[model samples]
Target: MIIARILILLPLVSANKPQFPLGIAVYANPEFDICHRDMRAVMETRDLKFFNSVIDKTRIYSWPLKNFKSDIESLHNSPLFQLVRKMPKGAALHIHHKAMVNTDWLYLQTYRTNLYVCDKHNHLSLKFFKTPSNDCNWQALYERRRNPLVRQVLEDRIRRQMTMLTEIPDRSDTNVLWEKFQNIFTFLRSFLNYRPLAEDHFYQGLLELYEDNVMYVEVRSGLQKLYDLDGKIYTTTETVNILHDVVTRFKADHPDFIGAKIIYAKSRDMDHDELRSFLHETVELKKMFPGFIAGADLVGHEDAGYKLKDHSSLLLEVSNWTDFFFHAGETQNFLLQPTNLQIAIRHNAKRIGHAYSITKEPDTLRELKEKNIPVEVCPISNQVLGLVSNLRNHQAAILFALDIPVVISNDDPGLWGAKGLSDDFYMTLMSILPMNANLYSLKKIARNSIIYSTLSENEKAAALDSYEKRWQQFLINVTMPFCDYTQVMYSWLTLDRNTW
Candidate 1:
């Protein structure tokens, strides 16, 4: 392996390197795993760069693909993408398996081969496919293009197909996005669950995410359906088995997935004890699959009055091996939002999923900063939730600017109707947060993701080196080749730092 040794030794020997730190989207929820045409379409909107200082700047390294024209040219005539493919990215911190994964693949697994999709009007719905017939199909969902309400339903279902090409304004400022967000889940759960849909969705979603350059995804999902009795009841074990099976099969397929972690979440509208039991059972079940299972969380409308503080005793009682990841400060409706952050940290949370309001409390902000905690900044989620109407003032800038380990993610890319991580990064880089867009800065963001992730130290180191080698080689070739960025923009390269 002389070649391998030299490859590792290469970067260390270079000085004044044009090398870029490895970068990645970290996480693209199955809910938000839209493909290529959809990704290009999303980046074309007027508001795409409506918030970034670099709105007029030539696209480069991190989000070049957002500029299909330039990227396509580079793809054919330049080596930027070749370099990009070599860059290493760490783990994707946020994901919702059910919503993030593609449902079509799931449909196929459970013997759902037929079609019940509405045409002309544009809508799709699957019902008892096996009982009826998979062979005699009326029309696939793809062919049917239903009307208004139906279109809205279909669009919502496929929102992860890509970020919406046009902006859809926030419906109500006061209604927390978390409130409206869960409806997507309830809607999907209410509609699909007959066959082993989780497996289909998980695989497809992972494939979509991998295509977007996301290696590891920590999926946060509400509990899989425990039962669907016609006014009948089934033990929670049935649901657990279904979830376990999905993970088992998924792991069999995607080894680099970094694995899926169950959120063991529940809607706050349910009985608290019922939720508690699920949490406890999930912790107990972790014995069956150690590293793959992450821990528990409580989501749904935050105003529903079931605070993490309420579960403090249970949380303290649980072993540290079973981590706690909370969705805190997602609400403007309650002052208790900050308190949730406090409890999350005090209880030793692995990370805060969407602590948007944590900055409002000066002391808590200091604590978070000092602790080196990461804020899972989901810009689209915040916009959709109406906590912040524009990316211009998204709190991610505050956390990131100050060097708080912050990682950008597509919280529910599917539901937000967006593609994978890069599009989100492009939107944020070009429009909103004026964070530095150079190679080192982008790599640091990627490192923060890995450093702050729940992955073990060995895993993080391995991922980090893997990313470094890839990026270095890509960049090295750029300098040696005829059309590298440095040579092509020799004039700009020597310009004052302020010109950037």
Candidate 2:
């Protein structure tokens, strides 16, 4: 009896050791494993250790931002942060177009002559007029900036109203933050509507993303007309054409960039008739600018807006070729199942943006896996918007474990004072992912962004090739200091995807 018991205990003890860790198995594809090996080798170098030490020291000085913990702010000055800025971010698929540039740029642009700010019932609206209007009590921004005493005060007020950097009110109240967030966007409309400012906005924003190593992007816009300094508005077609012109000019200067596309977004609050008209308009625009316009989305606060099922008839009216990128499951309502997520899945949405509440329904989770729907997980955006309290608890890791492809994005980086996807990438790796999440997972995430993007097959191949070359160069630069000369056999080129 004692011998039999010992034999059973021995088998149980051996069974406790997993045959393969989940992360490793999930990322065991040959192409990915090879690339990850090269990336991992560089990340483990002594140079990276020193970089991490600098980050560790700066954690104490980080600001207590409402979006992320103080420690995440600490990475702003670290060398690893610099390295991440160089890492191939693949693509930005879910960012808003107007929120792409910094607010300071808007403030400076409004200082030009003829611009006026009107305050009505504690709400501010900026407009351009030949002269001040007595009926609306319009204040000229140029005059405010000219006075030394008012200059600092005016700048402070503008920064606080346009961005979330200054004091945030009522952290516990998501409603308050949501209202404040909507107000900021409203205030920005006055400045962003100007044609010249809109042109400058696109140029500077794309340049910033290019500098931060993002090759492609799909910016969502409401397709609103841009107004001239005299308040004369351009047509929606003209507005999109203007964006294309700016993109063309930028590409002329930077040929290595894969390119950018647009996804027309309409608020979910619109009634059935309004949504039907908007859908027709979007379809017309897509025909006119087939290469530039990629898809459409229903955008707004999910909890308070109309559910996706409410527009099932209208959504089904869209052509099968047209992509539907739905923004669903962004609420924290545990009592309610994610019916919006289910609707998106049923409609065959090309991708889902911020499916934060998917964990509440297990059946939907299984469907997401079986259908292979990719999710655009914006961590900092989720935290800042009050959908999530901490990045560590974000549920993005759950998606990864379930074989749901995910891509990290900075939904509104400019509003939160982030340069590009670099900060979001760092936050996801350090705070959101599990401790066992390795370089392989990072590579897979990057590749997923490219493969799942709207880029054509030829463009995808070119982008991946470009990304691989830059990644190799980055590894060589960081690891050359401590690399052993004898261990050069597994160099980036020498290790093919077919090899181990």
Candidate 3:
């Protein structure tokens, strides 16, 4: 009787054991398991090739274990990156409007007619001038680029100034790095904000994402007034309408494209009255273009900006009018009083941007998990901005381990010459996530992007349906030619389609 009882308990315990560890991978189906095994083999083969080719053989082989700008070329050449580029990312929830297009493309716009450049206080500014002005010693860009030698030198200088790439990425101070980062946007604003160029820029930005297999995007736009070379200015309302028209035109051309939305953003350093005025304007815009305007956010360097708690009353008052997707906890200082994460949660933000320091606050992490608020993880942006030296040490890895919701995003991809979500996804997979992470991990993160979006319930359902079809096709395309027929059939037989 004792032997029989022990045998009975043994099977029960064995049956209760989990097939995989807790976290996003736990959701993997048998079909994904088969595909994952194949992907891993390819990854290992490609990685070994990369390791052998490194000039210093003594250096360890770790893809994306270095600075993003430094490794971008190699990443572009990577087979894994090609695979990720083809993967259907549901939505990009944390991109900024100003830096959406590649800098190289924006630089080409400088060659257009009627554009002028000015040098004042050792700062460069571009503007559309009807006639030349002596204010700040303005010169026509057309004339400057007339000589081939001068144009080549000018292009090189402008390209370097427009990007944060450097041979030595470790800046003496984080503040210095941020100054350079902001300065890039300030210089590019003139090119991007021009009326005709702005329209094309927005369209091309959408096309860039579409080509990379991303179906939807929510842009954090300041809605800065648009200007023309002809000297006419567009109001904020008109700017909103122009963006909507752009989306309409884009969707008409690409029917499968889900569309784009704007998160009206303002500098977090605004005084109370200034913030209030922006908030009221945001509310009116949302009312005017409910579908196009997803919500609002306060964007700037978190360390130097006003705390969310300082203007909590005003933020809370407008919560009903528009969703809040505040940028909180992007700093290294996790111990600051009234942490931005805490205040953002208290104010009911639809999603938290970055949350880089959340690992230090277990209580806040638990609250975010419990509340089901997904944090937009911009791994490259964090590394580029001096937040983390290596992608492996990023906090999103910890969050993913605990099964917290995370949506990978390219915060300002264009600034770094990264075109779409692929590079960020590649960095997350190669370094930030566990070695065992595979297609299922990508699937879960992709699903979270759509599920956590500000899209309507009906829209979410349609997007998911579309994502499923695309996902099925992707799996078949990537696995069928390489996978064993019998094994593929067996995995397909056991797959629970509803679970995904």
User: What TM-score, over all chains together, does every model reach?
Assistant: 0.67, 0.86, 0.89
Off by over 4 Å in 3: 1-20, 26-60, 147-150, 482-496
Encode model 3's per-residue lDDT on 4-74: one tens digit a residue: 22112221111122322465753434344554555333323123333344322233344455677776776
- Once fitted onto the true fold, the runs of candidate 1 whose alpha carbons sit more than 4 angstroms away are 1-88, 102-126, 129-167, 170-180, 226-257, 319-321, 431-435, 473-500
Tens digits of lDDT, candidate 2, 273-308: 999988888888889998899888998887675788
Which candidate number has the best TM-score?
A: 3
Q: Is candidate 1 or candidate 2 better by TM-score?
A: 2
Candidates sorted by lDDT, best first: 3, 2, 1
RMSD in order of candidates? 11.1, 8.3, 7.6
Q: All candidates' lDDT scores?
A: 0.54, 0.72, 0.79
Q: Which of candidates 1 and 3 reaches a greater lDDT?
A: 3
The alpha-carbon deviation from the true structure for residue 82 of candidate 2, after best TM-score superposition, in angstroms, is 2.3
Note the residue pairs that clash in candidate 3. Answer: none
In model 1, the number of clashes is 33
What are the per-residue Cα lDDT tens digits for candidate 1 across 1-500?
A: 32222222222211223222223222211222122222222222222232132223244433322322113333322222232333444556766655574333433432344434422233333433323334444344433434555655665555422222123343544443443455456446633554444445655677677766666777776655532323223344565566667766766776655555566666544566775676677778676656656777767656567677776776676746477777887766546543788887887677888888877777887887777677777776666666665456667666755666677777776654444565455455544545323334455566677777767899888876665554444334433332345443453233232211
Give the higher-TM-score candidate: 2 or 3. Answer: 3
